[model samples]
Target: MDNTKLNDSDPYSIRGSHPILRGQWITLEFSIIIKTYYTDSTKVEYRDLENQRIQNIQGLEDILNSEEIQDSEKINVFTNRLATLKNRLDVLEDLLKTFYLDTSFLDHVKKVRKEIVNEKG
Candidate 1:
């Protein structure tokens, strides 16, 4: 009576049936998960972008303070670029809300998994 949990090394593990219906459901759920994952990942990327933008603005301020490169034109250009980056950061903040909404997408995943399990049994 060998009672061992399923392991990767086991060749005869019951990985379950490959029914088309089940496969399709699983695929759909997996796709949703991936989409949600990507959305969440993008939020992190946006945060990093925001941090980089702040750093850039700080550096520009430092440069403006120094007597070197005291050209008004160059300072104006940097200010305009900083404004653009700030606008982009605002857009990314909105996208973060959308990414949070994506979390509700998991309800469908749970429902699908339940249906598959019930049908298989």
Candidate 2:
């Protein structure tokens, strides 16, 4: 894959999921994501996001523990920024989930869905 961001317009767009396929890629017309793991670049991006998320969480924890910030304004600033960082962390989580939608990630979800439907049936 090209050394670029994995956006909608990335190599996957042009390859049409070629790089994401499993087994004999050339022989298969289509492949499910459950049959594959995260690509090299995708894994790299995931790690980067994870690292950022950890750092942000640690910073927020530090701010909460700090005794000097008893004022509301500074507390509000930290809290607000913490909320934004939490949002970003959530997005990163969902991005990883998106990447693993076809793998065991969705399998467990599908199993639960099936159980729910069966109960209704």
Candidate 3:
């Protein structure tokens, strides 16, 4: 579907003494498609944050489960870190519902990812 067509309001707009059947058809079709993948922009950000937290927890868990680690205190530390990360993820998920979807936020994320890749090179 064309982005322009998705963004058009004329076909979806209701303004006439007699209802436009074509316009209603267009609007109904558009609404169905839009609703299927329509996550609030804030939810997307929250998802990213959640994924990051899960990655961190997995890393910590791997370290804790390693046979090379003989120190019980060190394992405890890793467990604590994972718990803290889970808490942070919960907070982000809660805030996701309140976030506005903005292009700039996504651009910033992309730039940060690029920087990380560059630094690793």
lDDT of each: 0.47, 0.47, 0.48
lDDT of 3 by residue, 31-56 (tens): 33222213221222222355532334
Candidate 1 structure lDDT: 0.47
Clashes of each: 0, 2, 0
Stretches > 4 Å off in candidate 2: 1-55, 101-121
- Residue range 78-103, candidate 1, lDDT tens digits: 77775674465445434434344454
Regions of candidate 1 where Cα sits further than 4 Å from its true position = 1-55, 101-121
Q: What TM-score would you give candidate 2 relative to the actual structure?
A: 0.40
How well is each residue in 1-81 modelled by candidate 2, as lDDT tens digits? 643344435543544444664223422211222122112112222223555322344456577778979999989988888
Clashing residue pairs in candidate 2 (N, C-alpha, C atoms within 3 angstroms): 34-102, 34-103
Q: Could you give me the TM-score of model 1 versus the true structure?
A: 0.35
Query: Which prediction has more favorable TM-score, 2 or 3?
Result: 2
- How do the candidates rank by lDDT, highest first? 3, 1, 2
Residue 116 deviation, candidate 3, in Å?
24
